[model samples]
Target: MHQLRTRPARRLVQLYAGLVLYGLSMALLVRSGLGVMPWDVLHQGLARQLGWSLGTVTIVVGALVLLAWVPLRERPGLGTVSNVVVIGLALDAALAVLPEPSALPIRVALVPLAIGLNAVATAAYIGVHLGPGPRDGLMTGLVRRSGRSVRLVRTSIEVAVVALGWLLGGTLGVATVLYALAIGPLVHALLPRLSVEVPAARAVQPVS
Candidate 1:
């Protein structure tokens, strides 16, 4: 998109803000104790196993995911690399400040709120079109290589991750299932509205 290239400041702002909010949303979900998204399940499990901070596990996992990109021929962009670092740092920061609520009802309420916020954050960063995060790029790459439906590839990948993470001692709860069901529709609804449109001339350019 021309706007993406030309309005670097706005795009950067959107990218960073989206990433920060994404991390915060993850923290919210963690504090809720309702479980987390698929990749996060793995992160949490690794954190527990290694006795490391969740954010540390997140960054490590992100880097490892990026390593998988090599065989897939997935190129990392500024946003992609930033995603590996910023989200982890932000999550740590958020977790540091946010207290875990004692009330069950309050914890329950955080689930939907975290899910909604995560969707918005996802759309915001993706709309910038700088690049897909490592996990997302892995999904797209697999779909390309295997010639499978996005739904099939994504579901298969997630199912495997959740299973492995659960086995590794991650929290698997109703929220995990709920988030899987809800995020697709929410991102679909939000992406068009959130996406930054390119000028007509730039629309025809080859996407990098």
Candidate 2:
């Protein structure tokens, strides 16, 4: 709340920017013809199976994930709703403009770039502390209710998703493995540096 109440402009900008950049990062990985983020593996697989655009699949999946929150009693905030909408739109926009490269060197190089962008994007939105994205909330809620360790719960969920996505024909390459290895440390390093701290409210003095 203090965050919601004060310095509204910067937080909103950071939230939307981060969401858009997140989508762009997803697009870059997809275009690289290498691999994508974990949730995106599921989205891309669904799109291929369904003959839909990747962005459309992302939006639908995000909406569905948000719905899962209802059963978990997780609350959504402005950033959460915006995350569902804006990332999909941004993905579509970026993909429409970006040309998929054929060169192996360029494609391989995109992996690290995309990973770094993803980390910065993640730190920006999460640092705002407005709300967790739907997927993240689901993981936390499951952990809370199931009494599972965060590591176990998150790993189980991601492993299930990746296995399903791979079965459904999503790309799983060295890039996916690299992303898995690097993302944790990258965000860990970037979050504190990027987090937007809302200052405490000033106390009012009694009337003289």
Candidate 3:
């Protein structure tokens, strides 16, 4: 039997690499003791509720979201598919490797760090020409079926999650705003150059 070879665009490869790097940066962000992404805030809440490691919660959530992608029949392409596992795995490992930060100064520093990491992650993620993240996928599917704009759907979801996570004792701070405002442009700027291939179809846009 002969093995078939598949060649992906260079840009896709760059995005894949970016995803892994972003995962690493996220681990540091969490460890920095500043704050976390809203989704991660939920993960922390779920971790406490379920009595599991944050990493375990990440894996569970990511897996559940990835499963939803099946129905969309959206082509994840190579980079997006890799993102599902790589981000989760790298996040878990990075958490273990990175020490939790001490003092308010370190935490403050982490805000920028997390922001930068997210930008890189977004850049890589978008580059894949694959489907969006599980959460993003949900929003896109909803919009396509219901004729709602993805922006509204995504904002609603992010607000709800952040609120819930905050109520559940997740830290909400400057980092949250940074994640919201900075990540988009950075990713937009970086994505085009990272990979040579563009998706034939548009994927759900990333929310900063």
- Give a tens-digit lDDT track for model 1, residues 65-123: 99999999877777788899999999999999999999999999999999999999998
Model number with the top lDDT:
1
lDDT tens digits, residue span 1-208, model 3: 0100223445456556777787787776677666677687777777777888777777778777767767865434444456667787788888877877677788788778778777766766665445566666666766777687777877787888888877777666667667777766777787666434433444333433
> lDDT score, residue 94, model 1?
97
lDDT of 2 by residue, 1-208 (tens): 4446756788889989999999999999998998888878888899999999999998999899999988888777777888899999999999999999999999988889999999999888887767778788888878878998988988899988888998898988778888988988999999888777765342111000
TM-score, per-candidate, Cα-based: 0.92, 0.92, 0.81
Residue-pair clashes per candidate: 0, 0, 4
**lDDT score of residue 157 within candidate 3:** 78
Q: Model 1 — TM-score against the truth?
A: 0.92
Worst 10 residues of 1 by lDDT: 199-208
Q: Which model is ahead, 1 or 3, in terms of lDDT? A: 1
In angstroms, give how far residue 38 of model 2 lies from its true place: 1.3
Candidate 3 regions off by >4 Å? 1-15, 70-75, 198-208
